[model samples]
Target: MKLGNIEEDSKMSPAFFLQRLPAQRRSALHDVINIRHAYHKLCEICEEVSEFYGFTIFTDMAHNGILVTLVSYFLLVFFIGMIKVDLISCISYGVIIVWFAFQTTVLTSYVTRTIIQIEKTANVINKLIRQCAMNKKVEKELLNFRCELAFQKVKFTAWGVFSLDRSFLASSVYGSVHQRNLIYVKYIFFKILGLAPWKLNLVTKPSKNRTAKTIICKFSYLGLLYNVLLTTSVFLMTSYFCHQHNSVQAQVDSLVTPSTMMNLQYFAVILSSSVFLNYTCRQKDMIGILNEIIKIDKKLQKYAFNSAKNGNIIINLIFLGHLIICSTLICLQYFFLQSFWLAVLRCWPAFLYCWLIVQYTIMLDMMEKRFKFINLNIVKLGEIKVNSEGLEPVSATRISFLRESVLYDVVNIKDNYNKLCDICNDISDFYGLPFLKVMMYHGTSTILILYFMLVAYYESKEFHLLLFIKDVGFVLWMVFQIIILTTFVNKTIDKIAGTTATYLIILIQFRASTPN
Candidate 1:
């Protein structure tokens, strides 16, 4: 029964015995050794990736350097032109450049992090390749590792405009061009939004405990404050900008200047860029959680399988919504704005930004709900007792195995949950300041657009119905975008409250059931 004792009695080294063993035994030994080696290689890769990802000084400096240079150049030109007639315009341009530089810095930081992630993955595969050359016996196993690493490469975008890699850039452009097909767009619309009736089918059953409701309400209100502050900030920005100019016409023209329009569009694009970074980060986070879930000793693959299916559905829905919003906004701009070509040039950036924002928010909402759903299911698993419910009689050995499996599953679930929490914290760290900037800048843009409309309405000697509708529609679109944006954070908070409650209940029961 003891292989070590048998080998010792044979007076042979382990490798010598391995070579002399029966063919089947030798094959099994070879396999075990290979698996152990592969596992060690994978762990080393993970450690290297994690270490490189944390040391982002190089990426940080590169990204920051570009922005700082641009800001310096703009500042120098602005102050040089101060003695000229466009004093106020120069100040406005300077402010815009400063804001743009700040946003670019934040966006670059995120891109740098993603690049490091990709680089480390490549490093892992290359290391495996090198090992394969040294160990011809494990070549097949190393090849498999290479394939898996290739499959797991993080495909990220830079500012949602172009792919991080040149190859993906072509594919992204094709996808955007594909949206021009009205029939395809319509088909997708029906596929996602048309499936609304089935949403109830997918919903989790109501929880028996209602304590989560009160907590959810509290968190919802807290999230609502963000929406309120954003709206209030818009009004404050409107007043400040309006007071800068003496005449109403001057205010309107100043806000609508070619430079102002371009800056606003650029700001929207940058704000939308946050969505690409955030969405990619969340996905990477989910992959980490899923990996841990699959590592549990229990038959956890079934649960992980279901979770992955649900997550994919959520991601698909978000993509569908993004496409729909993009098409709608583009059409809206053409219908409402001046010359078709000019309108497309000026308005496309903001519209594209809106689409990305909506996509990001929807992804946020569904991801939080998915996390809550998975946690609640885990809690239910914890509630099952070996002897508390009716069941077929089993041998003591079987029952003991069952009990151990249940405990192991629960412990693994708790560990994975903690890892998921860390992912949330990472998201917050990445999004916090950039989100604030977006809300503040977007709020100001919305107010300026509204004020521009008001100034137009009063200054016109004759009533223009078409002009009024366009103005009102623009304002309405901005308001609607903000409402949708705020709902994502609110829903995420509510789901978090429910998840926390479920976790607490499971912990309490687990403690009570533990023997002294």
Candidate 2:
């Protein structure tokens, strides 16, 4: 969702956009107030619809995925039967269970996608509000616009929920809905349709809330617990063979599931889920962002009453929430890895799901760009004078105005504006981050993870032929991982990056100091 420099430059150019406005003389207090109010109302409607779409869509899929996954597991259990709990039966059960899990994942992803729409709508509304606040003329006329926008937002959001519920119920025909024994065709015909083809792929009509939270909750808990148990088996196996066997058979068992390998897989799952969960939220998060943007815009109505402390505090709260959520999910990931690391990783479908989670997290972080809302301060009473074109030059005119401005530099305030624009533009152009450069930053960790897998493989394996080749391969992999790790480490938590860089920088300095 990030943009490039030119786009940012365009947005920052107040004069350019203001030129598109009606003639200055015609731009009286009353003339454009209605138009602004209309736009604001439209934005509110979009916001409500988006919110409804987000919450309902997520809950629908989550509840349904839980149901389908449980049914899938039960079907696998039925297929395997109690009489045969042997290796062949176990593998069969796992395969079927994985199939069911994937089916549920598809619907979950769909609902998750709505978050993006929500985020978009929210951003738009917020931008509109910011504009209204910044305009002194509009502010006087559009004082009542906020109340209307709020009302419309609530109304549309309610409708969105109803629509989402219907959408999910109908579209969930691809899997077992209720019991494993009830065939898909029966449910499709009797429960969903009664021969009504229109309501086939959506959900049950009349929207009686057949979401079945109980079934979903029970199944999710069981599925998660089962996976955990599967991971714990590694530890159990480790203990079992630690002193039980001494021969090659014992070595074979230990070799079958290494703890470190399991740890790596677990780490991967955490990394992946962090991305996926965040991405799911990101899909429809724009709606909320827009809403928040409007609130910020309203706050800017009192731009002269600004405080750096409040600004920073608001920003910190957002980052803090993201950290807390990510941390909590990572813990869940560790448990899953500890219990069923091999089995889950071995399941290619599950692996993709895990990977998707990480991708989403990275994207979610990237989508959060609040720095653009920096308030413009009017310092001296006469500093905010109209230009020949009647547009704001983005700075105070008088040197004495510096004391009252956000930058506290009334002199050449245009320069400060230009500086912020330059940074925004460079980031947009160089990093393609009109907003946050999340994907680019996250790429570091993903690359490091992949390199480590290859490194671990080559380092542990033995081949007598051309022994030097193995050492070269190991070194190559290590270097690759280190490079990617360095970039990500530099951006996310720079102190760690600084500590590492000090050594490298000093080495570079030493090499230069030695004068070759």
**1-516: candidate 1 lDDT, tens digit per residue:** 132233334444567645654553445446635654665565567446545543354364456557667656665544433344366765766676677566655655665665676557556656545532223444455466556656554434433333433333223223333222322443344223211111111123355663211100011232234334433443344334434422322233754774575456456545444444343334434334333333431234435423323333334455565555555544555555423454444454345345545544644654475566656666766566524333656676875776787778677666655655665665555456545655666577668867776776688746666556655665676566667667777777777677778867867876676557
Output the worst ten-in-a-row residue range by lDDT, candidate 2. Answer: 191-200
**TM-scores for candidates 1 onward, in order:** 0.42, 0.27
**Superposed Cα deviation of residue 297, candidate 1 (Å):** 15
Residue-level lDDT tens digits of model 2 in 112-144 = 455444335445545544543334544444445
Superposed on all Cα atoms, model 1 deviates from the true structure by an RMSD in Å of 19.2
> Number of the top candidate by TM-score?
1
Q: Rate the local accuracy (lDDT) of all candidates.
A: 0.50, 0.37
RMSD of 2: 20.2
Residue-pair clashes per candidate, as listed? Answer: 0, 44
Off by over 4 Å in 2: 1-65, 72-147, 150-152, 155-240, 248-487, 493-516
